[model samples]
Target: MKIYIITERARTITLEVADSTEIMHIKLQIMINEGTPIELQKIVFNEEELEENRTLKSYNIVNESTLYLFRLERQVGEADMTDERKVFETFENL
Candidate 1:
């Protein structure tokens, strides 16, 4: 079956996958195709978060189903000064 995936950034892609494919596999494919880390991916279907242990068929997802992708929020305490500086520097270059 084919599924439509929409990223938080509004990027869209259609992919063909088996109904038996696990949510984790889809997450991995997103990471590979969109460069979003699998650990940071949160997929929503029918307004419910898809479970890693569950298959698309289990969620009743079928052809042409649209899944929303969101990035997991980073914890405040997990922020690093170096990462912030890098982000600023990259924007400055732009």
Candidate 2:
């Protein structure tokens, strides 16, 4: 099935995935496509946050379903500063 991922920055990404695909896998795809960290990705459907361990089927997500992606902001010490900068740069480019 195809799903639409809409970022908070108003960017859109279309992806093909299986019904059994876990939310974590979707986050990974976003990571690969947008350079966003999987840990920082939050997927929401029907105004509810999707659990990483759950499958799309568990949420009854169908073809052409739209999911919102949000980047979580946190202070992860000095080691995470570069990653945070990258995420911001990605959105800035869009």
Candidate 3:
């Protein structure tokens, strides 16, 4: 079955899993990109939040079912143009 992994990290919903892998690591890594505090306890897919002890096998999830790492945080602030320019300039000089 075809399943989708809709991630909520930085709006980066990726479909990277094609086999048995620890999705928790991927979820955590993507969330870090947001550069903010994250509470894994509240992570969920659709309306059914995942539990700390729940593994992929718990749901009999196979190649058919899709997994998503959804982050439940609203992004704040906008990109400071000045900061971006400065960073770009620094990289250009190196």
Candidate 4:
């Protein structure tokens, strides 16, 4: 079956997976393709959070089902620097 995945960045991709595929497996694929860590991935289907231990079939996910993917936001530490490139670009345009 093919599942539609929409990333938090609004990117869309289709994945071919089996009904027996676990939710964690899907996260693994996303990690490989989108560079998102599995621990940070949150997948929602039918307005419900999909469990990592459950399979697609357990969620009654069928072919052509769409799943939303979100990356868990992490708290920025004091050592983290904000990207100032956008501000620089705006000044350049001015």
TM-score for each model = 0.80, 0.81, 0.39, 0.78
Candidate 4 wrong stretches, greater than 4 Å: 75-94
lDDT of 4 by residue, 1-94 (tens): 9999999789997999999999999999999999887878899998999999999999999999999998887545412233356656789999
User: How many residue pairs collide in each prediction?
Assistant: 0, 0, 0, 0
Q: Rank the candidates by lDDT, best first.
A: 2, 1, 4, 3
Which candidate should be chosen as best, given TM-score against the real structure?
A: 2
TM-score of 2: 0.81
Better of 1 and 2 by lDDT: 2
lDDT of each: 0.91, 0.93, 0.51, 0.89
Tens-place lDDT per residue, model 1, 1-94, is 8999998889897889999999999999998899777778899998999999999999999999999999997677665687789989999999
- Per-model root-mean-square deviation over C-alphas: 3.8, 6.5, 8.3, 4.8
Clash pairs, candidate 1, are none
User: Which lDDT value does model 3 have at 44?
Assistant: 51
| Model 2: CA > 4 A from native | 76-78, 81-94
Ranking by TM-score: 2, 1, 4, 3
Model 2 pairs whose backbones collide: none
Between candidates 3 and 4, name the one with more favorable lDDT.
4
By summed lDDT, the worst window of 10 consecutive residues in model 4 runs over: 74-83
